[model samples]
Every structure is written in structure tokens, then in C-alpha cells.
Target: MLNLLSGFIGLVALILMIPAVIPLLGALNWLFVPLALLGAFIGMLSSKKGGQNFCLIVAAFGALRLFLGGGII
Candidate 1:
């Protein structure tokens, strides 16, 4: 379902952010952070609580990366 897909994508984005502290990958966090947020939003709209909770956790991770990486103030 769409919820699962969104959560999966968010999870992938969270994984991708793992290396974002490196100079080469730092720029990509700009893209990944938003992608994760979008995925979380999509998943949040799902009727299933499980998917919503999972994606929200992924989104939180992405947000943490964004903040630590200086992508957001």
C-alpha cells in the first residue's frame, strides 16, 4: 500500500543520511531530508497507525540530520 511505500522510502532516506556528514554527501542531505519529510507526511495520512508511527520515526531521524548538518536553522 501507499503507506508502506512511503514509510519504506523514508527508511531509505534515513539510511542514506547516515553518510551525510561527509563533505561529499553533505549536500545530498538537502534532498534526502525533504524526501523523508514528504514520505512521512504521506504515511501519516494513512489509516494504519503502524505505518504512520514508523514513518514518523524515520522523519524524525531525517530532521535530526537536517539540523545537525545545518540544512535547517
Candidate 2:
């Protein structure tokens, strides 16, 4: 149950990031990145294979966005 919830959260975060890619919504990335991280953390804590995979993907994309946006150095 927790695993499913965590995976769903990660998937939702990824979906939210789509709009953030647009110039008008670019600033939204800041919000989405944290959301993604939260989802990833929750998923990790769930300790389920499916949740872990979802979290990994979300984390990777979030990190890439942060790096590209100069949030990370």
C-alpha cells in the first residue's frame, strides 16, 4: 500500500514537471523538483521494487533539471 502510494506520488511529480519545461512555467521546476525528491524519498522508504524504480527515475530527472537550471553545481 505504501509502496503503491509512493510510486504514484513519483509518477504524479513527473507528470507535473511536464509543464515546468515550458518557458512560461519554467519557474515551476523549483516546486516540482522538491516534490520529486519527496516522492523519491517516500518511495525509497517503502522498500518495494516498483516504488524504488519509480523513485529512481523521478530523482534522476529532478537532478537533471536542477543541474540544468543551475540549482546544483
Q: What tens-digit string does per-residue lDDT give for candidate 1 at 27-68?
A: 667778777777867777777756566766766776666667
Per-residue CA lDDT of candidate 2, range 1-73, in tens? 7688878888888888887665555567677767767776777777576876776787678667766767632
As for candidate 1, its clashing pairs are: none
- Taking all chains together, each candidate's TM-score versus the true structure is 0.67, 0.74
Backbone clashes, candidate 2: 0
TM-score of 2: 0.74
Q: lDDT values of the candidates?
A: 0.72, 0.72
Off by over 4 Å in 2: none
lDDT of 2 at 30: 73
